[model samples]
Target: IMLVSVTERTREIGIRLAIGALEREVLLQFLIEAMVLSSFGGLVGIALATAASLALAHAMQLPYLFNLQINLVAFFFSAALGVIFGYFPARRAARLNPIEALRHE
Candidate 1:
């Protein structure tokens, strides 16, 4: 998805680069986008798991407990993975030749 986005936004990236946006700034922009996407997915996953566990507990007549620490860790882990996975594409975008990118269609 990130790759596709980078491909689709080549012209925009070119414009930024042409306008003197730093490569690091482009990298940061994509990385932040990745982080936000992963974070949202993580939150949805956490919510679904919590709901399922609660349902199971109710069915078994057990007390449902909230595990904040584990959930936080899971969320952070996902965010970390996002940044790791996004780095390559972000770097690719950052390293794009502005003139060539601007000619992309």
Candidate 2:
């Protein structure tokens, strides 16, 4: 379901590519957007996770021994996800035939 909407967004990308933007440029643009969105969502997720962890610890009567630190591993995972998800859309958009795309209604 989510991917369907993503494909719709890709249409706009196709338009951009058809207008003379290079493939690598389109990929970079999508990568940057994905990184920005992922960072914002990751922050929200980390905050919620921290709150939930604290609440669960309190409820179960555990001490503050566990830590919720944003380590290198988390950064790597988020970056990987962003790149992985953004690549296909960027590639699809970059490959659009300019003539067909321009003709699209």
Best by TM-score: 1
Over 8-99, each residue of candidate 2 has an lDDT whose tens digit, in order, gives 66657657776778988877777677776666667677667778888988999997454435544565677678777877766666676766
Q: CA shift at 91, candidate 2, in angstroms? A: 0.9
Model 1 scores worst on lDDT over the 10 consecutive residues at 78-87
Off by over 4 Å in 1: none
> Model 2 RMSD to the real structure?
2.9
Let me know the TM-score candidate 1 reaches against the reference structure: 0.97
lDDT of 2: 0.67
TM-score of each: 0.97, 0.72
